[model samples]
Target: MLTTDSNKATEIRQAAAKHHGLPLLPRPTDDERDPLRWPRSLKLAALIATAFVNFTANFAGAGLSVASPVLQAQFHKTPNQVNSLLTFNFLLLGVGNLFWVPLGVKFGKRASLLISTLILFAVLVWTAKETAFAGLLAARCLSGFASAAGESIVPSIVTDIFFLHEHAAMMSWYTILVSSATAIGPLVASFIVQYSRGGWVDYVWVCAALAGANTVAIYFLYPESNFNRPKEPLHRVSVTGEDADKVQVVKTETISRHRVSVVSKSWFSIWTSVFTINREINILEVALRPLKMLLRPSVLLATFIYGTSLASQIILIFAFPSLLLAPPYLFSSSQVGLMQIAAIIGFSIGCFAGGYIADIITAVVIRRQTGNVYPEQRLVALIPGCLVAPAGCILIAFACSDKLHWVAIAFGFGMVSFGTIYAPNIAITYVVECYPRVVAECLVAINVFKNLVAFLFLYTAVDWVASSGWTQVYMIMFMLVSLSMLLAIPFYFFGPKWRGQVDISNVSEE
Candidate 1:
């Protein structure tokens, strides 16, 4: 039988080890032993929240073409100058994750979310009041910064709340919300601007209004999902002091004992029943994680593959309408916005189902690979999308090259929308699944790299399309899209093996 004193000593040593940060894995508990499935209501709520957040974040980016002139007229700037708002948003959104993700570990997901959501609301409200060009720019920059906290950690939130099986589809739904907003936000912005003499300001104010409304809704419904409880030592022992030697060991045990004692001693709980201690200072490590993730080979390669593709996607959305509508095409701005409906229809359902398809591929791959689910499983979803996007680019390119039937152009656009949305959804799912612990890191790095590329291409996209005509510009698109698809195979096949090679921190803690 274990004596009371030896049992207490064992407990002390275990606590010390945890404080020193040498955790093996998240221990399974009766509460957590609940089968790895989400409650139906909770799952639906998460999906809805993710979709809503995505839509709001993308509200302006989706229809910048329509909003561009309103901005140009108000600020007396060129199209490139107008598009800079998004460039700022992307930079802040990418880097803000670095700041907010750490909060998830220290304060838990709900509190972190509340803080971010509130800040987003306040910034948007303040943005609505800015009238001068510089004022508007400053407001937007801060709004973008405030918005980052929510956007950066959402994938982590999804992972925290949902199980493995639901991830692909849930992520897809989130993507759908994002893509749809891009497809629809401008359409809405255009109509709103047309009616309101205030024009571009109306669009910003409306978005601000929406953000404010969402803040209240989020606070009540969001659940705590840190999942990790404060660890306490509960070591098993014999009545004799035999295990005493284990705790007394100079090198390892000494380190462990000091750590646990420090943390345990520092812990001052409101009640003995408290199972969580706030580790506030360690938060800086969390904030800088996404920056460190770029050093990882998997994140770097995957970011290149996915980031460039996304940059192209954004460039197409922002630049293509003006190219097609402005002179010889002679289509009105409204007609251009209408053209997006074809793409929007495809992007919405295409994204939702793409997740299910990714899940299916992962399941099939798992069965074939001795019941193991690999990061590569997520890549299979890209296969069809990858091939389809290039083909769409070819058809669209050829059609634009010839100024062929508008119907031909629309058909190709439909395919492009479907293919583009699907492939990235796959990439997002793969990254989240592969680096579940450091998910916040991978997500933000990809966005930063993606947006940086987007900022660069956006500058040249107008000039390139203007000088070369749509067909040649699209030929480049076909090549880029085709290459992206072809590259998916080896990554999906070889990526799994590599994902296993990296040491992801905090999975053991989760």
Candidate 2:
């Protein structure tokens, strides 16, 4: 086993000999240590794989929008049929989280990340060879399922590796990879479809490269975080009657469960001890945790923000190519792709700003409260974006029909992209902080619900946004944003109350 720099080799030694009767295992030698240093190497490791995952997943999902017209002609299908591709992508993407999240916990997180990337590699290869539209849709759906594990577990990995002081910052950086990739997705897809002689083959190539690079980097550079390792074993001692008052010598039983997994394998499991409702829980209760988690307040708020904010993107995916290609713009698929660059740029800035800003705001709140920080404090940063998102949405709505400088419309859409990621990032950080015990489950449910919202909107968003016009749609976005802020207001004030409830409810493990 490679233990990074923690003298993990020493810990494994102590653990094996601690009367646990676990088999001794070989450890990595000096040559295997990570030689790369710093915010530079660490940032590269954290951002690069995440970016690759985002790039691949986004291409698989939204790349087709640029080629919708051709796909329709080739398949002899309707607009709605083309729309199913997006709907199908979102449908399984939401639910896929449930299966992968538990696996992430059961296996080590490192293994889960590697497993998903490998699956993605195979799926994309399959995608490139398919001619039938139905086959392509199925490939995309499977890709979404494979991608969900990466999306659900990434925040957890960030939280685990980085210190509490750095959690929001790192989380935000990762969020940028997501939000920017999303905003930029169709733009890249459009151009690829326009230029490639093989038509959509280019999309597959892009994902293939991204996934391949990420797989290589993760296998080499990514370390198993300290939080992921089993807990320190409990030390047991014995006493002599003559020295009853004095400490005794005895064997220690570590919290590290006996490698009930003595034999290494692709998949592994062990009995996990959990406390639920102050009752000692078996593996069954913990397994069932994701089912009930959707009902929690933090989760619902996360879902609302996630679902509502992402609906805006789905609208663009369905509408943008049609809007730009039909009008006075009359651009090629490549030009339409270039149009998305504005939104991508805006979203990139917004994602990075939101990540660091949310962290800073939460830090300030934490310090003011004397180390007793409320997770809702992160929500405070989202309120402004909530208000701004609608305004931007309305602008895009009006510009879409009015047919302004075209640049104006792009700017409006860009603002909407920025506004969307701003709050969602904070919402993500806050929700996880609020429910750290079920981080993977909470994210899976949030993504699942959010994906449902996207699925619903993708199938119908074109009609909804166009029927309502940019103006009416924007107004509706405004209302939702207001609702989010109003909902969040309580969080700022009563966040401490909920945190207290959670703290009070948690019994000491001893």
Candidate 3:
């Protein structure tokens, strides 16, 4: 065995094993197979593939919102009935993760992702071809289920491959893809509905084509990121000369013994293994883990903060077609589609502002505190999002009620879109950092609550605005969203302490 002076070893570890003065979390080992130790090129490729699938998933789900008018005319249905397609889809998008995430935990993320992508492709095609309204609704529901893996598993893959310090920047890219897809989906669908002879069918087929391509890409390009390395014991080092009488034990965050591979498994064998379930993992417990995580104060707070931000965007998507398609606006499908450009710009700016900029600010805060880093430090970034999003909602209400220029409504949409990316990026990064071990389940809980919140608002938003008037309904939403975002203040101060109160060791370790 190799040996060094205890003090010298500690110094070396401290100097070499830190990022921005913070210790490397879930510390990496020497094993080549460890994702932390993977090459930069490989890591980037995985991230790209993951982001692509995420975009395709959200694109498929939200793109249809732009086609609601066409669908209503084709099926002779009311706007509320047309809106149900998205409402029920959002509901299952959340609840479906309860099923898919457990499979990811028991099998592997690659398997779960591949399986879901295939299902998504099939459902998208079914949606394109379905003639009846009820049939299309069924296809939409299945598409939501297929999309769940894309939302929940991508975060786990991010955590598996990247260290804590890299999460904010990386998650920013992920969130930008997701948010941009939501905006761009409608943009693309609008053009298709206006220009393409196939109309709404072409939009669904576009998503289907992307999903099919992503499935093939995943089969070859994506590697299984799930690796369960056993924990290592403390490294004990001896002293020399005058300090020989004293010994010091240095604790590591996590360490693993390296093993040489005598045989390399075939790609076919590796692919086949993804479906093999590890019997040691309790399927039932894994399935129910998200529900238990929902009870944690940190998780609950993060969910509401993230959920409300997302709901703001969903409300805009649901309302835009009706608002812009009628009255002084009388916008064409293509013009309405152009509206998403504002949201895309907002998402792009928010990604950099909240993601890369936040990481830099976090480093500054860590340095000021002499290398101490807390998850709460990230919460500071949510402030701008909280203030801006509700303000945007208020702007939209006024713009619509007063019949202002369409540019005002677009600008308001941009502001709301900014909040969707900015606040949720921090909220998600914070919660995942707080519960790093249970990332898969934590994300499941977050997505479930987020989607449920969107579903409840969307299910009632059309009727509410019809009954209560746009000004009153949106004012209430603005207040609710503002109150939800404000909760971050208390969480920033007490979140760390409250996180300690919840024990996830049993579920995470298992």
Ranking by lDDT: 3, 2, 1
Error of 3 at 80 (Å): 0.8
What lDDT does model 2 reach? 0.64
Across 8-69, the per-residue lDDT of candidate 2 in tens digits comes to 54464455443222221111112222111123445456555654565567656777778888
Question: Model 2: residues >4 Å from true position, as ranges?
Answer: 1-47, 226-287, 466-468, 499-510
Candidate 3: residue 158 Cα off by (Å): 0.6
Model 3 TM-score on a 0 to 1 scale: 0.87
By TM-score, rank the candidates, best first.
3, 1, 2
lDDT of each: 0.62, 0.64, 0.78
What's the distance in Å from true for residue 482, model 2? 2.5
Query: Which residue pairs overlap in candidate 1's backbone?
Result: 16-260, 62-182, 63-186
RMSD of 1: 11.8
lDDT of each residue in 377-419, candidate 3, tens digit only = 7887666556888899899889878989989988988998998
Candidate 1: misplaced stretches above 4 Å? Answer: 1-29, 32-38, 229-277, 500-510
- Which window of ten consecutive residues has the lowest lDDT sum in model 1? 261-270
